[model samples]
Target: MKQLIIAEKPSVARDIASVLGATQKSKNYIEGKNVIVTWALGHLLGLKMPEDYNKDWTTWEMNTLPMIPKKTGIKPLPKTRPQLKAISQLANRADVSEAVIATDAGREGELVARWILQYVKFKKPVKRLWISSQTDKAIKDGFKNLKPSKMYDDLYYSAIARAESDWLVGLNVTRALTVKYKDSLSAGRVQTPTLAMVRRQEEKQETFKPENYFTLDLTYQGLSGKLQLKNPRQYKERQELEKLIKQVEGTPIKVVDINEKTKKEGAPLPYDLTEMQREANARYQYSAKKTLSIIQRLYETHKIVTYPRTDSKYLTTDLKQTMKDRLQAVTVMDSDRVKGIIRNGGTVLQKSVFQDKKVTDHHGLIPTEQAPRLEKLDNEELKIYRLIVERFLGLFEEPFVSTNQTIKAEVKGYIFLFRQSKVETYGWKQEKETTQKRVDFKIGQVIPANFVINKELTTPPASLNEGTLLGQMEKHNLGTPATRAEIIEKLISSELMERSNSKLSVTPKGKQLLTLVNPSLVTPELTQKWEISLEKIAQGQLNYQAFIKEIEQETTALVKEIKMSEDNYVDHSLTTKVCPDCGEKLREKNTRDGKIYVCSSEGCSYRRRKDPKLSNRRCSQCKKKMEILENKNGAYFKCKNCNITEKLDPKGKKNKKMTKHETNRLMKKVNQEEEQESPLALALKAAMEKK
Candidate 1:
């Protein structure tokens, strides 16, 4: 009997089959002497929609909401059903006595294979292939040491709980809001709280006020060194600062104290997906989503980088042998400087990069078993490869050493202090110039401290931009590394946050939404509560079912309160123009080229593009009026009211064109702006109303 092997994608399946002696290849699978390998296109099946149960409930309505089915349903996507069916057939074949699950070694990947097996009722004894790297040696070794499938049953259970809970909460709340607000809106456990974060930031920024403060700076020619105030700001009142400056004018400074300490700076932690994404965003101005996609392609397609979505930034002790191999891979790419660092073969392994406590889901992103052949790749691939190389090299280098000095003095009874630093050793910082730009200070170098006695100075009020505010939020546990990028992206995409010259500003629409919404619903504290509970559930310290029941009870009371309240939701996108066909109101939308007029009433689906050419050209009958209509065949613009169709070339400069993908992406923003209900917001709002 042959052993059946299943993989997450065709690329992985082919590689596995090659190592397993599977030479025969097909469109979606491969074959070996004793094993037949197949692939699932990411997810072969997903939870079914409410419409699947009954077509009558296709349109969302409040009465039919809270549609919680006792047993969840699943269906294969129509376009990919044939491929899934083939996989099912192979798994249940008469000659196949056993099967091996070779999907990704993550919780989600486990669920993907288990669900397919459950749906197909494949009763064959199963084993799991849990290798992170897809190199020939790793694949062969993994097959030689296959583990029983039951070992990962707990992981599968945890994943199922998460998926089912998301479905229950997301679908019900999404339907409820859409029905109540008369707009197609969605809410998710991840997406809603994410949106709330953006809204709150906008609110805080809009209401921010700047305060004024004054300081007295003392600059004097000193025999030892120049002197300046340590903590400059003395008072908020101008009269108070003037009194201090007057006392210190023309005062001879005296040295009070001097202190020095030697310090060593440890090497930075290896690259995790989040930290790498943040750096790439800051350095290259690339969005988080774009970085993830690029790294995913590098890992799954090119097999150069290790897993790209990891949270941990440390390698396990077992992976130490591969470190040297990884370094050698970089050397093959012609980086002599990095190669020279490893040529000495000195013992540089430190406990900092080999800790098991720091790792959670997986280890940090590193080079895979494959060599870094960046020249063979594209621009995006090369950029991602360079990041991995730089980080990997940084991990093996020595820690930086420096001397920190603090000097103190008193002039006219006014105590002043200053700080300076000098690098004792370059260490790992020598690889990057940006990392090496440390300010150097000698033990007794007398220099200007940027302050003079009797000089007027003012302290600017503290303010935070999007980036700094994000940093603050992260410190408070308001968002995770994975979610931060998405939150920022959503804020910008929703037009709740705008960037002008790299600074974030809140829009009028955003301010209005924040004022109208319930405060507790849009605060970071709500997510903090959820995150605490989520961590408990992950650790098996909290019951998953009990958590869901609590949420349901809270949601039940909240909805009733929202209905009783007198708060009115204003429709921001209301338009005065009537639809030509149905006489319903026409809503304005932002198209790729410009604004477009679309029908507001459901099922009408009428749309008309704004004609710039017709608006520009003057008509003969009425010199002020412009042509408004054009024939179907690329001809001339004609007046809609006058019915005058004139033939002309279509190559005028006034014509605007855009691809369908670009047009749809721009239109989606307008659609989202028209929506008022947020799933997470609605839930919290409903609960707060009851309170």
Candidate 2:
């Protein structure tokens, strides 16, 4: 009898199949004498939408909301039902004695396989293959110690709770807000809190007040020093400043003390997904999602990196044995760095980097045994690969050592201090550090210095960018590493957030939604506390049913809050177009997919997808993309924002600036296209223009 092994994606399945000797490939699965391997397309199924359970849930009605299902269920995604059917058929195959769950060895991976099995009613006993890397040895050992499926029952329960809780909280709150306010606004347990944080940051920026202050500065031969004061920079009165400056103008500066010490700083831990994304954002301005995609390609296509969606920045102790091979593989990418580490006796292993207990679902992302061909990488891939490779090599390099010298002086009985740092070793990676000039000073040495008032203003906090936003989200436990990128992106897609370059701005709609939301719902503490419960469910410390009960109660209360609130909502998105179905004003909106016009009425069925027929011409006033507007009058260009209109430039017009040769070149191209135009199409155009 053969054991059926299921993997998370086709690429993973092929890797497993090749290793397990499942050489007989078929359309759905690969089979061998003792084993068969198949794959899932990320997620083949998801929780059923509200409308699936009852017809009343179809419309966005506040009274019919909080549409709690008797039981949340699994449904095959419409586009992937064929694959789900194949997996079910393979599970029921008579020759397969048992099943192996070889999906990604994490909570989400478990859910992917469990849902498929539950829907198929696969009754056979099952085992799990939990391994971090796709190396041959790792896979072999993982199979040697296959875990019982029952061991991860708690994890499955936690996964279910997470999904169901999102549906309950997100759907109920979103529908209630949409209906009550007569606008399409979405809120979530994780994203609402995240959005609130963003709005809070914007509010802080908007309300910030700056105060100008002055600091007393003293400059010597080549060094600058600051004199100590009660309120360092706040010299409230100009007379008091002039008095202090006059008092210390010609005073001799005496060095009272010289204190120095040497210190060492170890290399940073390897990249988790969040850290990797943050670094990519800092250096290349790549979005978190973009970084994730690039790293995934490096792992799957190039086969040079390990898994991408890890949280731990430390490796398992067992990885020590494979360090040499990993080190050699990375040398192919960075010969000078890795080769030097290998040439010298490897450096001392820090316990901070090899703790097993600290590792969660996966260890820190590192390079694999395969030597990376630098030429094979795209520009961004090369950057991400270099980042991972450098971190991997850094583990074997020496720590950075530096010494500091602090000089203390007195001016008119006021204490003054200065510091200079000198690096003793450029260790680990060649990072830029503070380099100070070598200066010699003695105790009780008096030197003349000049002082001036260095005036400055108190600056407001920096705005939230994608990198800082991810860091904050992680700090508050708002979402998982795997889900944080999408959460930030979803806020932008919902039009709750606007972005200019890296900085994020909360739209007026986002602020309105935040004000309407329950105070408890928009605080990170609420969802963060719930995350604790989810973790407990995963560890078997808390029952999943109990968690679900809490979610149900929370949902009921949230819906009730919306129903009872005295604050009224107005649909600000109202447009000039009248709804054909209910005679309400339609709202012009932009979605990720395209533009759409929706009726403002809660129950109205009138909504149309408007193909704006965007134009290449840019608006002169706002510089936004213009849309093509064609009517009985004539074809014209209209700017959506500034309402600027200009008639479309007549085609085949000669460029006055073009030289004869250039004009001929342009005319030749146009003539070629004109000649290709069919006779019937030309005739139709002519007839329509005449009308």
Candidate 3:
């Protein structure tokens, strides 16, 4: 009998297989004399939706407001069906008596593997391979100390509870809002509240009142240069600055306090997805979506970084033996640039890189055993890899040191103050040229000390940019790494926010949506509570069912409130013309060039052509109308409707190409898939197939 190892993705599976000596590889699984390895494509199976329970629920209707099934079930997505079949076959093999769940050590990862096992009805004894870092040593150590799958039962329950509750609240509320508001608006547990948060910030910014403040500059002559205010300490009134200026404007000031304190600056904490995205956004002006996509490719395709989406920034203590190897590997890959930092035969061990407390689920992104090969990667991949390497090297270097000076002077009756700080050395900052680092300085080491009194200055309030705004948001955990990128992307896609000069500004549509939507739906506090509750459930301190029940009750009350609201939902896209037959308002829908008015009232035989497509054809994939490109052998159609391109090439470009045999096989496969439908889908079909 062999041990079966299941991983979250193909890349991770390959790494684990290589480490475990499973050299014989198949379509999706690797085999050895004593072990077999397979993988889930993120998720081989997931919780079924309400529509899976009944065909009638496909179209939104008020009657299906609270569609709760007695039991939720799982189904494999169409694309991953083949992979799921392969995994199930491997899991059920008679020789494979024991299984190792090597999926990502997270809630979602646990659910992805567990659901597949449950769906396939596998009865093998299962163990879990929970490792944060994807190094060879880590894998071997993890295998040696595998724990029973039952240990994570509470975690699994929590994950399932989260999925089910999200499905219920998200689907029900989205349907209710769409139907009641009579628009295509969709809301969710994470995104809706996130959207509300940005809107509030925008609102506060719009309504902000700026007050004028005054300051006086004091210049003192010194050998290094003119030293101004070391600290940005504020002044209460303009008269005080003026009085100070009069007293010390031309007078030679004496340095009274030369306070010097030794400051041991620590290296920066490691990179998490949110921090990385924020840094990229700040330094490179890259969008959050772009950064995430880059990191994803680096993780999945290039295999240069380990689990880029992880929230943890520390390495487990068990990984101490491999640190030197990892450092050597990095040095080999990058050479002299990183090698210079190594001490005592290419070893660079530092306290910042060897902490067990900060690590969870996964360590910070680090260079793998694979050498850095930028030539084969795309520009985005290069950017993400550079970020990872630079940050990693920075973790094992000395901290940046600096000195600060504060000079106080009195002119007439007012006090004049100025301060300045100078960097002594770059330290760790010198290791990686890209990573940004800041240091605090000791007071009164006046290098640029040349401040004169009677100089009036008006401080202009600094405007918000992506970096500063993200910095502030991070200080207050308004969003998580997994969500921050999606939130910013949502703001742009929904046209609720726009980027001007690398700064985020709210659009009119964004402001309008914020005002129109219910306040609680967009606030961050709601999601915070939800996250806290889920955390509690994971800790076994809170009841999962009780948490779910509360969510259901809240959602029900929200739906009812939306139904009873007196304010009419406004569709700004609507036009002056009303449907001729139904008297319902007509609205302008988006088109390639402009907009077209279409009568949205149900069962109304009315539609106006404001901006029809210049050409007529249909996209096979999306089943939407599009413009056709006629050629000799075939016509190519680009679906302006859904952005799908279909081959109709006269030059033998395959147009929905499928052989008669292939078509028959496909239909048979579809039938087979339908036969193996989920528990929810089977029940729904049995109950409502005839209707």
Candidate 4:
């Protein structure tokens, strides 16, 4: 009898199958003498929706809220039902005896396999394949040392609790707000607190009052020092500051004291997913989601990096033996730097990096032993790969050493301080030395002073960009490293917040959402508590059922609060134009594509593109761009500049325009095609059909 192995994705399944000699490939699985490999498309089964429990709960009504089922059931996700069936059939095969869970080695990964196993009612013994990297050696090592699946049952339980709790709170509260406010407002355990942080920063920006301040700088024989003050850095009255500057101007300054100290800074910790996202955003202005995607590609497609969704920044002790191979794999990218480390007796295995106790489900993001093909990588992949590789190499280098010097001078009794740093050793920084002018001073030596006063204004707190927001989320324990990016994206997609100039700002809808959402839901404390509870569940310290019970009680209270609250939500985007289908006023909403007019009625699902589609055709009279528009008559080109209109040819020329009916029919056909092709679209369509 062959052992069945299940992977999280088709690409991963192929990798495992290749390593296990399962080359006989079929449409759904790969077969070999001793193993049969199948795969799950992320999650093939999820918690049953509200309607699945009770049909009346499907409608969004104030009274029907807090739809907490006594026993939550699992259902096959409609789009992936075929794959689920394939796995089930393979599980029941006479030749397959025991199963191996080769899905991702994390809490969520455990859930993916456990849900499938439970749904298939696979009573055979189960084992788990846990490894950090996708390298062939790692895969072989993992299978050789497979552990009993029961060891990770607590992790599976925690995953279930997290998913069910989120559904309960998010769906119930979202339905409550949407029903009362008549707008598509969504709130979640992690996302609401995240939005609250952004809203708080915006509030600080709105209420900020800038104040002017002045500083007195004294220059003497190429030596410069700034006047230091005790309490207030601001000089509100310019007259008083001017008197002080005048008194200290052109006076002889005496060097009071000088202090010199040598300092050493060790290399920074390796990249956790959050830190990686933060650094990518700071350097390339890539969104957190964008950075995660790039690194995930580096991990899955390139097979160069380890897991990208790790929270730890330290490697396990076992990885010390593989450091040389990992470094050698990345030598192609920076041969000089990597080879130098190798030639100089290899890496030092710093205690900061190789701490097994600090590692969780997986070690830090590091390069695998697999050498990368530089030409195969795109620009973004190359960047992320270089980032991880450079960080790995830094672990071997010595600490950065420097000498800091501080000098204090007395100019007419007004004290001034100057500081400078000189690098004693570049170490891991690898900085080039440059000549800089130096000032030598002795105690009690007097020099002529040149004084200048500079005026500055106090600045408000900077807005939160993806980097800063990720930092905030990490600090608050708002979400795991894997889920934080999705939370930020959800805020943007829900129209509660917007990204501009690389900073996140609250929209009018976001501001209103904060006011309308329950106060408890809008604070980080709620998520922090939930995360702590979830962590305990994963560790087998707390019962997930009890925690879920508490969530149900909380959800009931939150919905009741919304029902009684007098606060109102006004749709600022509402317009006078009525929806063509529902006869309700259309709301002009800004989207990434452009502005769109959506029906204001909650039950109506009618929307149209409000922005005119620009066409290559130019106006004959004005020789400017023309807008392609259609009406009941047919397709035509119009120039807003000169009020010129021209009939488009109906013969479907190379530059032919489609009539309104044809355009809509074509869009419908395209959407239908996409629905057929995309799993997510199919799932959404299935849900809509059920409704």
For candidate 1, the per-residue lDDT at 7 reads: 89
Candidate 1: where are CA atoms >4 Å away?
Answer: 53-57, 216-233, 236-243, 332-334, 431-521, 525-543, 590-596, 610-630, 633-691
Which residue pairs clash in candidate 2?
none
Whole-model Cα lDDT per candidate? 0.64, 0.81, 0.66, 0.84
Top-lDDT structure, candidate number = 4
Ranking by TM-score: 4, 2, 1, 3
- Can you give the lDDT of residue 281 in candidate 2? 91
Ranked by lDDT from best down, the candidates are: 4, 2, 3, 1
What value of lDDT does candidate 1 attain over all alpha carbons?
0.64
Query: Which lDDT tens digits does candidate 2 get at residues 309-415?
Result: 89899898888888888888877776777767778865534458998898988999999887788887768889899888878777787788889888888977977
RMSD (Cα, Å) for all candidates, in order, is 7.7, 9.9, 8.2, 5.2
Task: Point to the candidate with the largest TM-score.
Answer: 4
Per-residue accuracy of model 4 over 359-427 as CA lDDT, tens digit each: 989889999999998987878889988888888888888888888889898876778887777888888
TM-score of every prediction relative to native: 0.79, 0.87, 0.76, 0.90
lDDT of 1 by residue, 542-639 (tens): 77677667656545543444334455455555589899899998876544456677787876878877554445555566555556454576546566
